[model samples]
Target: MNKPTSIRMCAASLLAGLSLLLSGCFITPGKFTSELVLSQDESFTFTYEGEIFFLGLSSLAQMGAANEEFTPQECYDEDTFEDRECTEEEIAEQRAAWDAGAETRAAEAKKKAEEMSVMMGGIDPSDPEASEELRRILLRHHGWDRVEDKGNGVFDVSYSISGKLTHDFMFPVIEDVPMTNPFVQMIIRDDKVVRINAPGFSAQEGDNPMGGMAGLAGLAALGEGASGGNGADEMPDLPKIEGTFSIVTQGSMKIRANNTDEGPNPTPTGEILTWDISPRTQNAPTALIAFGQ
Candidate 1:
């Protein structure tokens, strides 16, 4: 169990375990429409209407820990790299090693779950009560106009807020929920430059940090013998990232840089930059704006 050996195994199995080990804390966007309006006087209004997913890393880890099943170690020819029958002594030795470490691994997994629960405000994604708890938490905030749990860790929410750009801002800032990668961010510099980015708004493969948890859940379902052609249906229903994001800027502000494909389109109010996001989107939306003529 301790020695590194290349054994023939399904790549899905590796991904299943890796997802549990590395999924960690993260929040990502789902279907939604978002907009930001920036004025010449450094005032702004931001609105987001759509799904917000919260993945509980501890619950994922606990699932992994509880579902771990041992597969017999395989022996292979060193030179040819071909599978061969393992010796009786070798098999016994591997079993002994696995048994020796089982207790330690369980203890470590338990400790990690406990620590993560604290970090995530004791909300367990696997718990039936988690959705209501999350709704209550978000409703206590100012911007959240509505919060409805759509199951499978997805929440349909409507958030609208306005303020002067006196400091940096980030969305989905829930109280007691430890900070993870944000859905959207605006960083204001002392030089009167503002950088806007929507990291979790795109379907780019690696852009969503919590993306792996979906696979983890699917694998867990499969491992539990979810069959009869309904395994896919039984898998957790994670929301997809499909939405639109736009930014409106006053004419007095200078647009230094932006990644919009068609450039800014003129509107009656000012210039608007938009992105139609989907699974095909390869990059997240971003832009830079500077104050003063």
Candidate 2:
């Protein structure tokens, strides 16, 4: 007779199996705030700060392995294939096995966390002096930017980008490339911002890499005739995006109109515009900044 495992253990194992299939395409939800400061001479400066949160299976695996309170039991007898009672000794033995596996699971979890951290955070959360690979990518696409140390888990970035580039066709293409994965883009025409696109994250389309395990686990449970399985319409509660965007023009320039889809607030300072945004899908704009001529 096959050995019985805890429902949680089976769920974790099922997730592990699914993790392999859904590795690359996962959505992460997060928040951001950005400001575009434009000079009268057409020089442009943009600033951004934000945070993202996600759940990875490695975290789940670590939790499962570390938890020893839960016990596994065989519901049927091996001889007559009838119902049976699980003994205290059997539960203790199974708990011991899980305990032995905890160390290995912890190590694996650490490695996976590191990988995901780099992919999402773009830098080590603990080390600020580490390589600026993500920053370099931003420079290549946006402009040569400066990073300011905010001293307490905060970063303030300023970029002096080419104003001429905004009006060019290549701006959106360059921004959307896989390497940068920038959340915001601007398109200018006739020395004015004709359109701005903030295309949000990949998480909106059900590509969340972290939630893939739950999806697979649910399927496995349903296949096994588990009565408590969630319905197909139900989805994991994942993070969504909320943020603010602003633009201000210096000197004689004026924002004749705010054509952005978000319909941000206009500052009393004149030529200053702001938008509070919540992104629901990739195709939907979180914030679009348009300056009227």
Give the least accurate 10-residue stretch of model 1, judged by summed lDDT. Answer: 1-10
Writing each residue's lDDT as its tens digit, candidate 2 over 151-233 gives 22223444344454245321212232222333456666564654555444322324543332234344444324321244233
lDDT of each: 0.71, 0.46
TM-score, each model?
A: 0.76, 0.42
Best by lDDT: 1
Error of 2 at 129 (Å): 12
Name the TM-score of candidate 2: 0.42
Q: In model 2, what is the error at residue 46, expressed in angstroms?
A: 1.7
